[model samples]
Target: MVIAIGFEGSANKLGIGIVDTKTNTILSNCRRTYVTPPGEGFLPRETAQHHKSKVLEVLKEALAEAKLSQDDIDVICYTKGPGMGGPLQVVAIVARTLALLWNKPIVGVNHCIGHIEMGRNVTKCENPTVLYVSGGNTQVIAYSRQRYRIFGETIDIAVGNCLDRFARVLKLSNDPSPGYNIEQMAKKGTKLMSIPYCVKGMDVSLSGILSYIESRAPGWLDQGECTPEDLCFSLQETVFAMLVETTERAMAHTGSNEVLIVGGVGCNLRLQEMMRLMCDERGATLYATDERYCIDNGAMIAVAGALEFETGQSTKLEDTFVTQRYRTDEVFISWRT
Candidate 1:
């Protein structure tokens, strides 16, 4: 059986995973996230250093958990692009070193493709319009003509980044995740305050909304105009509504009934419920991975890279470079017919 080991250190999260090529099952998944204090964001340089220090330990744990020797792996896979430069580079260097050390073939996988492939694997959703949402990315995509065509996306910052920044403005906890805490707080919200709802055609602009909310939030809280819970509720409702509308539009354009949500923010029950409502109204189905697979993790990378390797896709040492601006459509989907 073909087995592949994947390393993912795209941002603050460092993941090491192993997967079975034939069964498409994850054998082991180990991960660590570099979390900053409340009201702070992680720096790329520091996050890179953290991953550098932790990758080896994480790799050992993953191998032990999987109960497999390095020699049992057929290939090594690493996330190559569309992530923080420093973190991506650290993983690339480590992956290349492992490739040479283990005498194994190396494959580079797109981070976004990793999420999509993993979402498909666990959900068994075939030919669905995928809504990929995370701290660094937000896009509505559909597979067509050998590629995942992006129909709509955030024109400015990603949806998760917007939420994270907003949560920081409110000094929310960053232990599990800012988004998760915000979701819980929003549940206690009874009042739905007014907020910016910006959706321009297929793309959404979140910076303006974030600015507007941040500016009004302080005054509202001081004047007893709105509580933090209310603000969180309004923010989630507005942003998630915009996302659902865009995804529904993409599904209409592609004439697809299935919608798959992936990435860290995809774990939000509020967002999932909103998507479910729209899908139900349209007589469609909604698919999403649980928090474990939904968030950034090595399992996603392993799944995508294993498929790439199984289909004879491998990267030479010289080409195993990481990039920060790789677009989703730039990748060729060779594993699928």
Candidate 2:
């Protein structure tokens, strides 16, 4: 059995997974959310420190659950970039150290590529336009010419970040993620308050909506006019609609009949429904992965690393630096034959 260990410390979550690459099966996976107190924005150094403290614990748990020894693992894999520098450094240090100690080959996989790979694995779609939405990113992409091309993306704040900001504005619970809480509240509300929907040539602007909602919250609460649920529902509707529009446009432009939604935001059932409805109207298929693969996890990293390894992609020690803004197109395909 070809065993590969994957590590992910891209955001507030630290994830580790063991996989049997020969069988394309996930042997074990474990994740732990880093604690970020309210009122403070995401701090790269603090986030990395959190990862440093918890990564070993999570990795050990995953290994124990998989019933595998460290020697059983043949290779190490990790997310390389498009994330906070401090958090990325924590994972990179661990991966590089492990690679040196174990005398194993290391692959640095792109985080966005991992998302797309996991989506493809779950959906089994050969050629599908992907809608990748999350706390740090929002993009409409498609695979072409041996690379995933970004057709449309957010120009300002990411959809999840916008939601989280709004959640903070409303003093919503941060536990279980602010986005998930908003989703739950949206399900409870009925009144649909109108919100601005901005989409410009496949690009989206979320900061405006976030600001608008924050400005309107006091009047709505003081008048006891609209419930929080209604606000959540309207916010979701406006944001998700823009995402759907960009994705549909990408599909039309690329001539892809299938649409696959990936990333943390994709876990929202309401968003899934909106995409599904759009796909149905267009006579196209829509695919979404479960929470395990949708959220940032080690399994996807392992899977993507396996693909890169098979294609002969390996990272050099000197070239192994963390990037806070790594783009998907910047990666060279060393594995594709």
Candidate 3:
């Protein structure tokens, strides 16, 4: 049994996963979320602090669940960049220390690529165009030349970020994550309220819609005109439509017949339905993974790391560093070799 351990502390979430390479099974996975104060902007230092404090607990929990120990692990995998520098650094330190202590190989995986690779592994999709929507990202991606290329992305704020900000504006519960609350609200919504939908070329503009929703809050509340559920449903419909459109366009442009949805937002059933409908109409297949592999987790990282290690892609202590904002195109495909 080839056991690989993965650590992800890229955003406000800390994750650890253990995978068995031989069976391609996730033995254990755990996630701990850090809260951001209401009305406060994202602070990298605060995020890092949260990771520093809770990562150990999460790691221990994952190991216990997997019924394994540090001695049983073959390699350590950590997210290298395209995330908050502070949080990334915390995980990087843990990964490096463990690798050195165990004299094992350490692999640094790209956060976005981890999402994509996990999508591929779980869905078993062959060369599909991926729609990656998360708190920090919204992109249409395709893998080529050993790297995942960004075919289209948000021109402004990410889709998940937009939803989070909107959720905050409505005084939605921040606990258990705002996205989950929005999803619950959306289910109760029956009315269709119009929201702005803007997509320019391959990129999208979510900031504008966020602003529009905020401005109309007073009016919507005063008249008892729109229930929170209605608002949630409309928001999901508009934002998800834009995502589906962009993904379809990418699929068309690339002449790819398959679509795979990944990332945190990909767990939304409405979004999945939209993409599935689009693919069905186009005579293509639509693949989506469950929450276990869809959200940022360690199992995906372990699986990704095992693949990278097999291809001789290892990170050096001197070279490993956190990047608050790394581009997807910056990763060179070392796995294909």
Candidate 4:
């Protein structure tokens, strides 16, 4: 059995997970998210500090839960980017330190692949049109030619960031997550107000929607024209509909019968419902994992890294650098071959 430990803290949440590849079991997974006050988002610097302070404690907890010592682990894995620079570095540095200390080979896994692999593993979907959405990324991906090809994606700000910023505008609580609060508030909405529906083919642009909503919100509330629930409900309806539309397009174009949604935003129940309806209409299946696997967690990184490690993909100590612009298609998927 191949046992690997994964460290993931690309953004606000710091997670540690242990996976056993032989049985496809996530032995241990623990996460701690750094939330900012209302009307604010987590900063890259302080978020890094939070990870640095808590990384060791989380790792210890995971190891205990997994009932494994450092000697039982075969590999060390860390998310190698397309995330906040500061937060990414802390995880990478910790991974590097642990790799050296334990004398384990380190594998740098793509954050996007982490989500995709975990989703596929949990859902038992062999091949599907993947809609990956998160704070930093939004992409419609399909595995073709041994690559997770990007068919469509956000051109500007990510969908989750747009939601978080809108939540800030509404002064929603960020205790658990801004998106969750927005989703809850949206449930209270009676009317679905109008919002700009901008879908340039499969690619989406959320920044414009965010800006327009921000501009009109104060005025609308002052005029007693709309409630915060209305705005939240409308925003969710519009954006999620856009996402479902693009995902369905990808499924149709690829002739894929299964649609897998991954990333932090994948935990939204309303989004899941919308996607499910679209899939049912098309006679395709919608596959998604629960928040434990859907939200940014170490299990994803461990699973993806374990696959790469089996194929002899190991990152040298000097090559363990993280970057904010690593595209999903850059990493060659050798396991597929």
TM-score of each: 0.99, 0.96, 0.94, 0.99
Better of 2 and 4 by TM-score: 4
C-alpha RMSD of each candidate structure in angstroms:
0.8, 1.5, 1.8, 0.8
- Which 10-residue window of candidate 3 scores lowest in summed lDDT? 34-43
On residues 1-337, what C-alpha lDDT tens digit does candidate 1 reach at each position? 5888889999889999999977877999999999899999999999999998999999999999999998899999999989999999999999999899989999999999999999999999999999999999999999999899999999999999999999999999888899998999999998998888999999999999999999989999999988899999999999999999999999999999999999999999999999999999999999998988998888888899988887778998999999999899999999887
Give a tens-digit lDDT track for model 2, residues 116-226.
887887678878999999999999998877778899999999998999888887777767788998999999989888778899998999998889989998799789989
- Tell me the spans in candidate 4 whose CA falls farther than 4 Å from its real position: none
- At residue 233, what lDDT does model 3 achieve? 92
Q: What is the lDDT of residue 202 in candidate 1?
A: 94
Residue-pair clashes, model 4? 0
lDDT of 3 by residue, 1-337 (tens): 4688999988888899998888888899899878766544457898889889998889889999999888989889999878888889899999998888889988888888888878888888889998999999999998888778898999999999988888887777767678877998999999989888899988899999999988997799789998988998999999999999999999989999999888998998889898889999999999998777777888888887888887767788787777777787788877653
Q: List the residue pairs that clash in candidate 2.
A: 311-335
Off by over 4 Å in 2: 37-41, 333-337
Model 4 CA RMSD to the hidden true structure, in angstroms: 0.8
- Checking candidate 3 for backbone clashes, the offending pairs are none
* Model 2: worst 10 consecutive residues (lDDT sum): 34-43
> Residue-wise lDDT of candidate 4 within 1-337, one digit each (tens)?
5899999999999999999999889999999999899999999999999999999999999999999999999999999998999999999999999898888999999999999999999999989999998888999999998899999999999999999999999999998999999999999987777789989998999999999999999999999888999899999999999999999888889999999999989999999999999999999999988889988999889999999999888998999999998999998998885
Model 4 worst lDDT window (10 residues): 189-198
Q: Extract clashing residue pairs from model 1.
A: none
- Model 4 clash pairs are none
Residue 134, model 3: Cα distance from true site in angstroms? 0.3
Global lDDT of each candidate = 0.93, 0.87, 0.86, 0.93
